[model samples]
Each structure stands twice: as structure tokens, then as C-alpha cells.
Target: MPLTKEDVAGIADYARIALTPEELDEMTAYMNDAIDLLEPIRQYDLEGVEPTFHPIGDLSNVMAGDVPDTSVRALPLDAALRNAGSSRDRCFRVPSILGDQGGDR
Candidate 1:
């Protein structure tokens, strides 16, 4: 269904969006136009056509041999920790939110 200005305003209020009057009207028109455009698709005769699960051309799993390739570079611990907000012993540290870490449980 096409949305009304009141409907858009209600949604904006629910989402805590501060929309200007002009923006509200624009968004309402866009929402209504989207709904109106979709209406024609429902009238199509798609009775017997099997619903396609994936729209892209046929997909198949490309499998490879499980042999390990070891060209990946590992950064030094100190270099990796340079950009962290907090670190200890060359490791990035973060607040322990889980209670077990603080023995609070």
C-alpha cells in the first residue's frame, strides 16, 4: 500500500529521525511511488513458472585440493598492535564485558 504523509511521519518518529517538512513530503512521495510501481508485478501471470531460488546463472561449488599453501605473511606482534586503542604485552586489549572475566558471576 502507498504510504501517506502521516504514515511516513509516524515511522520517522518511531525511528527517532528529525525530518524537515520538505524531506517528509519527499520521502512520502518516494514510498508511495515504490508501492505503486510494485503493484503491477502482482498482476503478472506467473501461475506455472517454478520459483527460481537464485537469479544469477547456475551456481556450483568450486572445490580445490586441500593441500596447504604457505605464502601468507604474518605481521609482527608490535606492528599489529600499533593502531589499537589499548594494548598489553604486544596484544590489543579490550574491556572484558563477559562476567566470567571479572569473576563477577
Candidate 2:
């Protein structure tokens, strides 16, 4: 089924997004188009195909492992916070980027 403007608007509202009427219409059309594109795949017959986790089968540690360097030691919390301009309860207290009204600062 094609997505309606109300459906798109509801999805936007659920995600805390503020979209104008024009944007809602555009997004609804776009989402429907994407769904239509994937509709052709439903006709394929794959009754016994096993579900795959990765597209390129059995990839083992493709990226470098996290091995800590022994030469450099981690700084203590006090030492780390020594140069900070403001701190509270063992944490850095930076100025709020979000305003009191929940808008941008």
C-alpha cells in the first residue's frame, strides 16, 4: 500500500521532526516510490534459502583489533580534570548547547 500524507506526518511527529506540509507530501511520495522499487523482489521464490547475517559470507575481523599500547599510561581523573574550566561531580560541565526552552542555543 502507498503511504499517505497523514502516515508520513505521523512518522515525522513520532521521530520528533518538524516538517512543513510541502515536505510531508514530498516525503510521502518518496517513501512510496522506495516501497514500489522493492515490490518486485516479492515475486522471487526462495523457499529453502538460509538467512544470512553478512552479505559477503563469513567475514572474520575485517578491521584491526583494539590492542592497547603499553608505552602510554592513562591519566588519573584528577589529572585529566586539572585544566578544565568547569567540572561537577567528577564530570566536565560545559555550557548547554540546547536552550532552556529546548531550542537551539
**TM-score for model 2?**
0.49
**Residue-level lDDT tens digits of model 1 in 2-100:** 788899999999999989999999999998888888898999999899888887646765678787556877676777888899887756777777645
Clashing pairs in 2: none
Candidate 2 has an lDDT of 0.87
Q: Local error of candidate 1 at 99, Å?
A: 26
Lowest lDDT 10-residue stretch of candidate 1:
96-105
TM-score of 1: 0.41
What is the C-alpha lDDT profile of model 2 across 31-76, one tens digit per residue?
A: 9999999988988898999889999889877877699766899788
Best by lDDT: 2
Candidate 2 Cα misplacement greater than 4 A, ranges: 63-105
TM-score each candidate: 0.41, 0.49
Candidate 2 has its poorest 10 consecutive residues by lDDT at 96-105
